[model samples]
Target chain A: MDMATMNKLMECATFANCYPRDVVFRQGDPATHFYSVLSGYVRLFRQNSEGREADIRVCGPGDSFADELIFGGDTYEYHAQAADKAMLARYDINRVRNAAQADDGMLARAIAGSLAGQLQETMDCIANDRLNTAVQRVALYLLEQAEGQESPASFRLAFQKSLLAGKLGLAPEALSRAFATLKGLGVHVHGRIIEIEDMDALRAL
Target chain B: MDMATMNKLMECATFANCYPRDVVFRQGDPATHFYSVLSGYVRLFRQNSEGREADIRVCGPGDSFADELIFGGDTYEYHAQAADKAMLARYDINRVRNAAQADDGMLARAIAGSLAGQLQETMDCIANDRLNTAVQRVALYLLEQAEGQESPASFRLAFQKSLLAGKLGLAPEALSRAFATLKGLGVHVHGRIIEIEDMDALRAL
Candidate 1:
């Protein structure tokens, strides 16, 4: 972590400490504070009109959440909750923006840089969701997770299959079918761990 | 718009500007400068091995494209072409990163801010693309076009339907079908202009 970033965040926002499994902000509540996850995981979600919760994103260490209101927009589109044992740092969006506007330099760049990274990832996810086949989507998702990994033949799933399915825009059943297809292709699935027995065959499939 | 940003850009990279329809960079070419649209529009497309074009994005005024390579990565995943009479400001990724590392202010913040906005918009687009039906996607697209308008009932489609189809991840045939559906819903589509005859009906649909 960058000490300068930590100090700037401390200067710009109030840290409302939160525990694991705590509700950070509920959907429909006014988005007041932009957050940084100092430790643990934070999940963003929304309930459909039918009241079914759909996970939006799971943010981990060094990631920020509840930033839609940072643009000075009104209202919240989603709710945020801690996924596990976690600690979060909170800051007022208005104060952060004001400080950035006043200095027009380091702090401004810090926030913008963070936002930019988030934007690029979001766009990529959109592209992935547009793919037609469940298998193709799962392949793409796994490829993204395996990106930069030293060993691509095997890796741990970042989240559960159902949550992963939601992110990929597929029904959980479709995801299960996708895994079955991969298994047929000789890929091994054990809980959250995936091992490609024949890398060439898996890639070819 | 900021003089500081302009100066920073100048110090970063040199670009040979091109006319509308000119190819700025090809899909398989070595990833080079990260281009920022100074004015007009630029379209990013990927060509299959068989040489069919698939448009990824239509970047317009104040939009920055070609960022995938900046994170110590190589290879261009998409090609860029001028969509109109356009002026693109290019920045050598290394130069900008080097400069940003040394500076803690406006220049860095501007880049970060741009990135953040782009990410959020992309994520929202992805989510919508996955969750909405074709007709719903068309409706949402129209609303976005009318976002800053005095009246939300009517607006111009920024790009041709063919281009729009590519961005929306639909076949031209499917897009035409979607347009016909929209027409049935009392939304008017003529050339590049779309007018919603009944906002309530359109939303209800």
Candidate 2:
């Protein structure tokens, strides 16, 4: 987004604080506003009728959630909750729509870009889940998380292992086994922090 | 899309014909145009590095493809091929962009809606692949295809069983097993045609 659009959006922004595990919104709730995380983490998920939950995407600092709800649907399709205590900026959908319609639709193009990028990522996720084995899926995910970091990089996982397993469509035991198998690829897991000793070998998986 | 917008798009459209099994565009090709199916069918698929192909979506008459490529990326992420002999209308990306920028961005909102709907469908597909069993996925797909039909609905499958299996992320044998199981739910399959004798019973699966 351009500075002018950001300024306009910020002018209509309302600040909210959420505690860890607080529900930000539930599936089927009215999609009245768009949210941007200022700190901490948030997870978006969907539950089936059988009560099985699938993690969709997790948002971190500077990331936005539920923006797709602004266009096609009247309600949110997934539930969102704070993974940790966080500050967020909420902008009314109407205000954002109006701003997008203004200034020759520069903001609209930006929104389109965001949605396209999201669609690409989701398609990639679907392909990964369909094409890769559990171990390969875990390796691909580590490579994804390690993006933009230097070789021999180390970073803390944004969510718990169970949540990651759900996101990757793997059972907890399968996830554990996958992590153990990654030891052969030079990946070390020390609690939440992961150190990648050989990024090229990991990617070759 | 409104009549005026449709007229604008049509004015910029060029007609093209394709034979069955002909590729319209390959993955990673320049996304220079958007396509609307004028007749017949087109299948969009992705081929992994291992030469395994996964069907992503199939577009029929009046349906559009590659709208997600209109923003964020300059290349198509999936390959488009004619599932049958087909006629298509193609619109130049630059012309469409110009038109969207004109007329107070009414066209922009329509494009946004299209992108949002595509995102929702893809996400639903991902969720279905992740959360549903092979049998459940086949049942759900039958329900989806039978939507808007009468209770004792019978419709011809749009594609072959093998294609359907690929689209549902199931192996051909698994799909056959799913079909056998669905027979218990009053679903009868004859070649490419499916007859759902009891809608509620099928849904109850």
lDDT of each: 0.70, 0.83
Instruction: Give the candidate number with the greatest lDDT.
Output: 2
Clashes of each: 14, 0
Q: What is the DockQ of candidate 1?
A: 0.35
In the range A1-205, model 2's lDDT, one tens digit per residue, is 7898678778879999999899999988988988989998888888887778777777789778788876757888888898888899988987787777665666777777777777777877777787789998988888888999888989998878877887788889999999999998889999999999989988777
Listed per model, the TM-scores of chain A against the true chain A are: 0.82, 0.88
DockQ of each: 0.35, 0.62
Native contacts present in candidate 2, fraction: 0.52
Winning model by DockQ: 2
Off by over 4 Å in 1: A11-22, A26-28, A38-40, A46-56, A67-77, A98-104, A143-156, B7-21, B27-31, B46-55, B67-77, B94-104, B146-155
Worst 10 residues of 2 chain A by lDDT: A101-110
* Model 1 Cα shift for residue B151 (angstroms): 8.8
